[model samples]
Target chain A: MRAFVLFMCLSVGCLAQRPQPCASPPLLTGSLSVSTQSEKLMAYANYYYDALRRRIRLTEFGSYNNKTFHLDVLLLYREGVMYKMNYKNQTCCKKPLSADFHPLEIPWNASLLGQVVIGSSSGPGQGVLVNTWEGELQMKEGPAKYMSTVTEFGCIPVSTLFHTIRSGWMVTSFFNNVIGLVDPQQLIPPHFCQGAQLEERLDEDPVTFFSLF
Target chain B: MRAFVLFMCLSVGCLAQRPQPCASPPLLTGSLSVSTQSEKLMAYANYYYDALRRRIRLTEFGSYNNKTFHLDVLLLYREGVMYKMNYKNQTCCKKPLSADFHPLEIPWNASLLGQVVIGSSSGPGQGVLVNTWEGELQMKEGPAKYMSTVTEFGCIPVSTLFHTIRSGWMVTSFFNNVIGLVDPQQLIPPHFCQGAQLEERLDEDPVTFFSLF
Candidate 1:
């Protein structure tokens, strides 16, 4: 009986060490704020993600390279295409999106940074329980390190920090996330994107490239 | 008939020029991200607002003055007290709060910049409509200019930009706002704040001061 009790204690200890992986809701919408360490660039956007449909959309308004721009970016993973629409010039650039659809989830090989409560957890429905995970993404150029914090329940992304040699450090925070899409048509290309010019050049900036995921 | 039509057109134009003021929901919760133009300081926090009760709470995690800190701040306007709790040291500071309870609303004297849509607005339920308003706050030290963006439907705060001579510029963005309190007890002071030391010194930083609003 004592040996059996010891074995149960050991089982519980092992379970506590390994946290379960979490995946975000298939169809979600949220607001994203991105800022780089240099502070030269800042972006605010509302994003729509449909993992099942392999589509993502971002309506971004921010300053880049000292110039303010309003851009609408749509990534169609199934079609292997991306449309970047510039509101000021009424122009759209269509480019090949070679990145595969990467679902918002903690990777199996990620290192768990433990769990914490955002607010007071003494009472019911008090605090937000979140898990932090860190991992490295192997890109064609180099490996980028990332740390992501997500809600423990829905796996809704809260914030992500990505560091690359080229980009230094960039943080993307997601907030006001809703579990479902408000309009499916938002995932479709905008009216002005009909005659988008095809561009073969790929964006080398890690901040812009990593955003595809 | 021509005179009547002309009068009606002038009245319509006057009404269009005067945009209506908007107030946020009395009780709401959301996440706030703050950053300065200098790139030295950045903060992330979850805020709980009880406007009707004149109470606000913030659980913040960020780096300040090159030091990482986790702070929980609770403001009780009715009691005219503010408590700042440091999670790392388990210390709480209680101070006299002199600021009046200011409801989150567009000021009557604010200039209406314009209305804009965040996403694609060609179809129903495809975009978020928001209004921007700019105004100045009269403070004891000096006047600080501020611009706020809020949703037109529910007056939910989206982002606010405040500029002062001392703080230069700071932007606070709100997201994932949901109406109603998940836990009313969150507004109450935590148990650790029972014997908080009274702090008489007022913070002079405009970024910290304006956050009271």
Candidate 2:
């Protein structure tokens, strides 16, 4: 009886110690196509990254119930600020830096979950979904306790274009076309609004994680 | 300039007021096939619901990194307890009741995001993924916010099967067959182990939400 008991202990112990299968982080840069999908709506976005400069540009287009929504932001780490520019409306809004918004930080070291490559059969290529990267990116700063898949490329290659599922938001992002290098000149806007269209804004209300649908 | 400011306010307000598209709670009873996917693993589980009797049975099979995992649980709200019976290992375990463990208490009223029905080409039927009600269901209990969609069947049928993208865990559940009614006898195990195989245990550590991956 004692020997049988010992065998049971070892069996359970072995099962618990089994190793998980995941690849180390791959080289990732950026992309132009990313989208978010929920039960009712699908929104598409674009991203540009200057890895050496640690800069990011994001533009999101959400059309639901016949109304159009847009968020265009440029994050310049060197300047320590984030700018929300709407090209269509010809307005540029600037917000100061705070703990809540760090657009340049990528959660790559978080445990890897898996890899997914999606393609369209008829189209010549594909586009991954890019996250707008709004709200408290600080939630990612906690210890990495869970395992999830990361893409090799896109706005944040190692990060999902969408937010985490834990936030009561299950938004996901995907992109397809792979552009090799972004020209430095491409990062510059043709013009920054100089007149009254440039609005200086303070920290707007921080979006509660749940408020992001 | 004042006219332009008023127009801007109206534009933003109009965009914000656009109504979300969602149906009311769906009348969903049970499903046969549901699967969960993460970066490293994919787990499939089935559920049997006796809605009238308020009983549920879940059987899950997972194959990860060449290892297989199985969980069989019987939840009888009437008895005010839940049972985990492992037929393969010939062991049965039980856990105490808490507001956190009620799998049948659908968070229908919590919030509604959207609804999805997935089916394969070969199978004509469809199923909604019912979470076995494991892990910290506490994650589902919180103030509801966000506007997505809801199904017509579930408590919030217009809502999502399970929260799609939060908790550092993106658990997607899919069922192919819609089982109308569960016969009561199906809920009973053929036999309970008479003596030694039944191990009396306390609340084993509740699985972290990410561990479900």
Candidate 3:
């Protein structure tokens, strides 16, 4: 693929921003307790950035010695229906479910070619079930092309506070503790190396070839 | 799903802690045309929100197309190579190339044994790329469970302002422009909507199921 389009055009000439410090940075996982809680998280003006939280495009499977496991989707609702708190620590009894979203048929006037097509009576189901104003409800799947979204944030036990819990970072209120993993897709392309490996190309004319699987 | 998880646990127990002046805005999209020579962007901040510039990232397919076609996924470069006058309105007649780093593997090393898998003895060829980062680069296949990073901004076109250009809001700007089309296995999930299909079902009696395919 032309080297995946030249490794996606190698990093455009050094770009730099983020670091104003009007105070606001809940989590993005650079750690040192999120650079000292990003200066007390912008003192409530509408901050949010524990690595940009808001994602739950699930379908991940299991693995351990072979590597690949990052579960923590949990949405929680318990007794009525919907439940998907996969658990990271596996304790405190467990109870929070009510997520199915019937398959996102949601299309109110839709625009952009009906959000990419879905005329058929809303039965075949692709996904949709909105209600998130933070009322905890969003299950959107596919539309803007392959889409995936699942929401629920209001659960943090952290094994009752660090027996040893570090991955970038996160502590969230023992005294306002808020290290990493606030979500932002878990700080994309950051955490890796429990068994990381993907760079081998015994060169023929290779300066580098590392992602051609 | 339990009445949408009891209306998202009573709507995050009432606005996930209130606050919303600008907590997580910045996503802006198309039709763009603001550069009337404004530029003040977070200047040591003290309350900000022009709708926080247009706020984006509900998964972002460029916020479902309003800004023509914008998509950025964590574009930040520090000498690792990325320049085309810092990418805006696109115009790199070809010159800068060699700036390599192939380590795209991270499967699971946030701990808790996820197996971790992002290897590439040979993956991504080598050079000839774009997407320097100022927005519009989104593509991270199925699992980046750690989510690494993903960014994208809009309003390009300033090939040297003969036509007179150069606006603001590149999040502070520093060449955050990388339109790199590495095609990270994205067929559209946020609204790209091409072959998109997922209604899923495989039951026989649970509420008279057996539908999704």
The numbered model that scores best in TM-score is: 1
Q: Which ten residues in a row have the lowest lDDT in candidate 1 chain A?
A: A118-127
Candidate 1 per-residue lDDT, tens place, B46-140, comes to 88888899998888878777778677888888998888877678778898887777888888888998765443233233234567899898867
Interface RMSD of each: 10.9, 14.8, 17.8
Candidate 3 chain A minimal-lDDT segment of 10 residues: A204-213
Descending-DockQ candidate ranking: 1, 2, 3
What lDDT tens digits, residue by residue, belong to model 2 across residues A99-150? 2333333344443332322111111111111122223333443421222222
Error of 3 at A35 (Å): 11
- Native contact recovery (fnat) for each candidate is 0.00, 0.00, 0.00
Place model 2 in a CAPRI quality band: incorrect
User: Which candidate gets the maximum DockQ versus the true structure?
Assistant: 1
Model 1 / residue B197 / CA error / Å: 16
Backbone atom clashes (below 3 Å) for every candidate: 1, 39, 106
Query: Which has the higher lDDT value, candidate number 2 or candidate number 3?
Result: 2
